[model samples]
Target: MTSVSIPRRMKGVQIKNFGDAEVLQYKTDLPVGVPGHGEVLVKNEFIGINYVDVYWRRGMMGIPPNGIIGREAEGTVVSTGAGDVNSLKVGDRVVWLAMGGYAEYTIVPASLAYPVPADIKPGVAAAALLQGLFAMSLSHKIVQVKEGNWALVHAAAGGVGLWLCQLLKALGAKTIGTASTAEKMKLAVENGADYVINYEEEKDLVKTIEEVTGGYGVDVVYDGIGKDQTQNNVNVVAKHGTIVTYGAASGFPAPISHATLTAKNIRFVGPAESALMRNIGGGFEKWCAKLFDTIANDKINVVIHDTYSLSEIVRAHKDLEARKTTGKVLAKP
Candidate 1:
């Protein structure tokens, strides 16, 4: 395996106990991890900040004890571990979907790492990789969206939300997006939402979406804002339509009776993107390729809401949780 001059210590954020953003402890003396079998030691250049990270930090999601608090990052491989690494070698610029990303260095399994093309900037790759693949899985795998299909996307200005807008647009779907503010609504529209609703102002959101679709209701709803919007999703879905609830920004959606779905023949699924990716053969590589290709061809745009230094992670989480961000947020170590 190839190796380089590695450091004994690096900077990272560790969560000893789950609670809130303050639980994330930034330290300069954290040990740099070594790559194990089929793993690569990566020097992270840019780390992606996702809402899911907040869940992990707050104990809403299960993580290993004393775990680091990030899921994805883009970096350069400084060392390779034992065994075949899927043709990856030291010095390869790659993006990975894995745990422990809120660090200057990470041990990434080669299977989760994809080489970044020369034209794609590290920050762009970092910003788009996870969310782009997630959006694809939601629109294509979770439910096969067809041309002219109507999709309702909640938090349409968010990381995954914006990507959903672009992907659904590329598929010729009519998208109705809900955002909290005028600026967010504009961003959603620019990303390809056919209709945007300021949910904060629109007292009757269900009625507004129904009107946009001419009383037919949306064919599918991508709901990231759970709990508060859960019942509303059931109310606005068309007959036989699907609702993919992937995140719980507003808290996990309340459980529903099976009969509620049966009443409209609606399908409710809430698969995490990691599970969805693993279920399909070569899913990681396939979606990563699709994401990079689309970006290369100008088929999609990567919006960066902000970039924070690793030390500023707490403020970053606060911004995200407060709905102060419109697109992907990145952190540089």
Candidate 2:
């Protein structure tokens, strides 16, 4: 590792009291701690904004108050602690998902840091890590979408949805996506969706999607929008098909009846990204390598809805919660 300048203090967003975006506090006096053994210090250049970050800000998730709040970020490594951990070196450009990413600097375990390719911008790197991995696992592993197969993606303009749609296209599968508005539907189409349904204006969404698929239901349905979409997804899914419901954006799906599944021969599955990564067989390194190649080669592109400076962190959360943004939002410090 080469020598680098050190700093003693930096700015970070502190969660003093969790309630909403208003509760996020920006502080310039946060201490920049030295990296501990097996960890490296990253000067965060871009912090990825995700709904999970909203969960933390809304107090929906249990996390300590007065701590930095962010999950995914891309940055330059400035230093490393003792021990040869994960073959990390100073000056390496990297992506990481450690906590405290909404800061000038984040200290992450070397095991958690992955070097980014030269051509991948910090915005793309930050957006691709969490959502990209989820899309890869859901499209390629969980669903095993083959050529000519069909999949339905709800919230197709969403962070994960857009990426998933692109990956499905790369695999030669078609996507029938449902978006809330005409603009969003257009965005979905631009992101590789073969068919788009304006769910907000359309009645009988399931019937519409079925009509698109020529009366045969889709092979798989990615339901990020829950609640009322449950029955729609079930009715629109083909026999022996799978439903991958990963999020409850509108709210959890209403309790399901087992008879419904049995009658349609449907299989409902939802796996956490952490657990699914373990069962991916090839490990995170290989999965990431393939995913990065896809993005670099233009097989999949990160659709950034908006970008904010570190000072506008609160507005970032507000934009996401109000559904005013599509795809991914990024925060640059």
Candidate 3:
């Protein structure tokens, strides 16, 4: 431990009751928690706002009531509890993914805490972990992206959508991104998308994709936006192509059909976050090392759309649900 002044009380957003983002109650008088053995208390510099936070707050996920709602943050370790926690020490700049991140100070298991590169900005570091890994897994692990493959990324200006576009480009693949607004379409193009589809102005999404590919169709479709788009995704993919329905932002997708998958030879699977965590958790240190290298080399860009104070979390969530943000939304306390 160093000579940093530790606070006994902190501010944070807690789920008063699960429903909408309105349920998030920002409390200034919450007690700052002490780190247990092998845990480190982080003075959060920036907390990443993700849709999963919405799921937790909406009763769609299993998080308990009064749970502080967030999964990732970048901060400096202000104190450490007694245990062997590898190379971590007080004052080290690190990124950590753990719940209770919607706060001024968060306690994270030491092993899950990763050191941030000195050159990486705090916002970028805060943006990198879960969303970045999800993008990486889709490219490198879930489906090995090959050179010259054609891909479709829905919600292209969204956090993971931009990452998917950039990483696909790095792998020598082409991406056609679908976005609702012209601003979002331009953002997708800026982030390495080969083509941008303004789905708002377009009527048939499947037709647009087919026309872009000269009727050849895309090799992969990343459908993070669900609802009716799920069925339309099945129609748009090429023969032997793959579809990763990683999320359902619009709502839960229509039930998939085995007959359709068998008929098209399309491999339809969802991004298994928990399974990925189990398999890659042990190798995360190495993955993060490579991620930093890629970032340093400017292989991809990490965009910070907006910043909000912890007290304005309700506003942040409102803006997020309204689709007014692009790339990553960050909050600092």
The candidate scoring highest on TM-score is 1
| lDDT score at residue 278, model 1, on the 0-100 scale | 71
Q: List the residue pairs that clash in candidate 2.
A: none
Q: What's the TM-score of each model vs. the native?
A: 0.98, 0.95, 0.96
Which TM-score value belongs to model 1?
A: 0.98
When sorted by TM-score, best at the front, the candidate numbers are 1, 3, 2
Question: CA lDDT, every prediction?
Answer: 0.91, 0.85, 0.86
Q: After superposition, how far is residue 117 of candidate 2 from its true place, in Å?
A: 1.0
Cα lDDT tens digits for candidate 3, 8-27: 98899888678877799989
What does candidate 1's lDDT look like per residue over 110-198, in tens digits? 99999999999769999998898889888888899999999999999999999999999999999999999999999999999999998
Model 2 regions more than 4 Å off: 64-66
lDDT of 2 by residue, 1-333 (tens): 489887898988998777878888888889988889899999998898888787777676678434787887998899898886688888999998667888999988887788999988657999888889988889878889999988999989989989988888889998998888888899999989999988888978877877888989899999877785888888889999999887777877877679988998988987667566556768777877887898889878799988899899989988888878899999998
Residue 309 shift from truth in candidate 3, angstroms: 0.8
Clashes of each: 0, 0, 0
| Cα RMSD, model 3 | 1.4
